[model samples]
Target: MSEVYDRLRGEIVDGTFETGAQLVELALAERYGTSRTPVREALRRLEQDGLVERGDRGMRVRTRSPEEILEIYEVRISLEATAASAAAQRHSEFDLIRIRRAQAAMDSTSTDDPAAMAAANRAVHEAIWVASHNGTIVDLLTRLNNHLTRYPATTLKVQGRWAEALDEHRALIDAIEQRDAARAHDLARDHMTKARDLRLQIYREDPTA
Candidate 1:
């Protein structure tokens, strides 16, 4: 059941099972070479995980409204700010190293590949969350981030966002390294605010976004 659930979740994330697509138990069972029982269990778990929702017919990949997406981003902005503040106050040298490395990875990613750049950006954020050393904040952020993956499109694709975001990230690192919690909080909050606006713009420009 766990294996089925993991695979299904990955499929959802990678767009193999698109948003609003039906999750037919028998079809999925045949596709995975498993009985309907495991597929059924996986669907239930996915529903609980907010990756699937019950519809008029059956479970389908969940889709958020624009309002809901904005709400999630608002919550994320607050949480990310808190995480950055905490990280500045408490992060170890090794934590700083990890965050820097993640940023370096982003810098090395090809400019033509927005998807790869976006993934590397996610890695940088993940490292910052871990550096916060607050388990509750980290867990909340991870779950919120999962909700965000439904959008699929990267804000880095917005004109000049890739370069601008990298500059913001560098500022964040400097704040954290300087142990300026207040500055770090402000930088993170501003960073997320820009990202939220850019993403909504992306969604407007492209229906798939």
Candidate 2:
């Protein structure tokens, strides 16, 4: 059942099962080569994770509205800024190495490869969360990050967004490395605000966004 749950969740995150697509139990069971029982259990778990919801037709992937996406980012800005502040005070040399490595990966990734850019972006943010040394914040950010994967487009894929993001990340790392908690917090907050604005711009240009 856990295997079924993880595989289905991965597919949803990777955009294999798009938003609002129905996940019929028998279909998923056949796809996973598992019995209907495990498929049923997996769907239940995904529902708990806010990735799936019951609909008139059946269980479908959750489709977030533009308003909801904005609201999520607002919350993300708060949480992530706090995490950056904490990380500034708590991070060790190993944590800095992980963060720098992720940043370097993002820097090297071609702008044409949105998927790799998105993965690298995630790595950079996740490294900061781990550096915070706060289990509760890390767990909350992890859940928020999972919900973010449901979006059809990556913010990093927007024109010129990757370059801006790389610059913001570099500044953020510098603030953290200097143990400037206040500056780290402000930098993180501003970074998220810029990302939110860019994402909204992308959504305005594309109805599907």
TM-score for candidate 1: 0.93
Measured with C-alpha atoms, the lDDT of residue 162 in candidate 1 is 90
User: Which pairs of residues clash in candidate 2, taking residues 3 or more apart in a chain or in different chains?
Assistant: none
Worst 10 residues of 2 by lDDT: 200-209
Candidate 1's residue-wise lDDT over 1-209, tens digit each?
Answer: 88888899999988898879999999999888899999999998787767899988899999767786789899999999999999999999999999999999998999898789888999999999999999999999988887877888888988888999999999999999999999999999999999998888877777566
The deviation in Å at residue 21 for candidate 2 is 2.5
Off by over 4 Å in 2: 14-16
**lDDT of predicted model 2:** 0.89
User: Which candidate ranks first by lDDT, i.e. highest?
Assistant: 1
Query: Best-fitting candidate, measured by TM-score?
Result: 1
Candidate 1 regions exceeding 4 Å error are none
* TM-scores, each model vs. reference: 0.93, 0.91
lDDT values for all models: 0.90, 0.89
